[model samples]
Target: MPTDTQILAAIDAAFGDSPRPEHFTHYRHCCECAEHDELLRHRDRETLQHADVGNAGWDPICFCSPEGIAYYFPALARFALAEPVPELDWYGWQMVFHLDYGGAENPFFQHCAPQQRQAVAGLLAHLLETRTGLLEMDADSALRAHGVWAG
Candidate 1:
């Protein structure tokens, strides 16, 4: 397993140049939500590193545009690498890997460039190896059931 620092380095290499979006949320209905408001507070900022994404919660990530999700992924990954809990569900990391065509694909995971996909795969593999309890998942079953294979 790669060290956390190495995993983060891979993330930076893959996603560092992704542009920030004007609005982080895709749907207008989400615009009225408190989480959306929080995300908006960082819209004018150059980087989201200081944004409290965990406070904004997972809904924004689930509904955001491809650019929006890419912009936030580094911060999201950082949060997951922290002391994650099952209830927080790794801040919706699984949502990105879920293969359901019935409105379940994360725009970032679905439309990301190949390099981005590899970076995500590395991150997921690292998480599964070191944080199984925090992820609250069986590796093989998750890969089989959710189409979340990284190998």
Candidate 2:
């Protein structure tokens, strides 16, 4: 099993060159919401790194643009792994691992490049190895369904 440090490093290497969107917006055109406004306020990756996932009263995972989604993924993963916040855990799991519950597409997989998708596969593998009981479904089936298990 890979350590958190290793998983994070993989995430960084995969996403390092992701382009920042010129004008960030929601995945859909929705009425102005706090989460959307908050995301727009942060222009740089470093600033978004400091964003509090809980501040918007919701996860804001699906509502973000592809660029913003990728940009925020690392921070969200870090919080989910390192911190004991259940909301982050649930939302993070939903965003990355749960395929049947949310949007028709896995936003991370759909928005990310091939390498980025591989990195996410790594992240899921790490989670399965380390946090055995957290995932709700048949783990192997879920991994297989997503085709995230490289092995």
Candidate 3:
């Protein structure tokens, strides 16, 4: 199995060094990724105290909220915001961050690692219940933007 170091190095080699892939993994089957996934989840809940952070983030634990989304917007939307998403599942949101941070065009969507996919799942697990109305999620990726961000 790939060590966490190797996996992270791969991500850095591929995605660069600003937002380190510390909390996420691009490799799915990696046991290390699965382990990290669980760890990040625990960290997420602990950090938020399982509450909706209207504009909260950036402590030892970083989570997505209405506030964080703006920070990540448009930079890596191509992969995350693609139309015809089959489901508003894990990968859907994972693509929102931890990808090649640029825009809809520059990113090589195909290059996303498995751990990155897992990251989306963790993000959604934390925010879905807390957020409301803006994300109209169907059974699948038929995600629709119903309204603007609600305060």
Candidate 4:
């Protein structure tokens, strides 16, 4: 099997970009990293097709995708076992999101009201456009640095 670093380089090359040496991760499998940008780009069809565009089926558990569903139930149950919500940071949220965790179980997802789906979508679009890189290097950081939160 290829080492994680090799996988990252291959992913970066596929995107026509050099490997970002500065993107060292706090966790081994960092979420929303630059490498993921290219990976997701390759799966544009699946991502676009499964995107929660209409928000009509936004359940409290948010187990829409079987992939997301797997993580969702387990995470929710774990939190229930522990009691109280966990205070996850931006990167943490991205990890869960990218890991297929969704629905009301996600603290970030719970923050978005049903009517605010469009706003959430808008922010998501901006994040992808800006390339958060799952760290302080991307557009989200630039926006946060400039005191701009909402999209």
Give the deviation of candidate 2 from the true structure as CA RMSD.
4.0
lDDT, residue 17, model 2? 74
| Residue pairs in clash, model 4 | 62-103
Arranged by lDDT with the best first, the candidates are 1, 2, 3, 4
**Superposition TM-score, candidate 1 onto the true structure:** 0.70
lDDT of 2 at 147: 61
Candidate 4 root-mean-square deviation in Å:
18.6
- In candidate 4 the C-alpha lDDT for residue 60 amounts to 22
Q: If both were scored by TM-score, which would come out higher, candidate 3 or candidate 4?
A: 3
lDDT of each: 0.59, 0.58, 0.31, 0.31
Candidate 1 on 19-137: residue-level lDDT in tens? 87666664456444546646655553245532344433444455566776676667766766776554444543443344222332544556778788778778776776787775564
TM-scores for all predictions: 0.70, 0.70, 0.24, 0.21
- In candidate 3, position 3 carries an lDDT of 37
**Candidate 1 lDDT score relative to the true structure:** 0.59
Instruction: Tell me the tens digit of each residue's lDDT in model 4 across 55-151.
Output: 2233222323322222232232222122223343233233224322323354434443343333333333433443345433344433332222132
Considering lDDT, which of the candidate structures 1 and 2 is the better prediction for this target?
1
lDDT of 3 by residue, 5-52 (tens): 343343334334234233343326566545534544444311432122
Residue lDDT tens for model 2, 41-124: 554556554234444345454456667767666765565466446434343355343332333365545677778777867877
- The runs of at least 3 residues in candidate 4 whose Cα sits more than 4 Å from the true structure, single-residue gaps closed, are 1-100, 103-112, 132-151
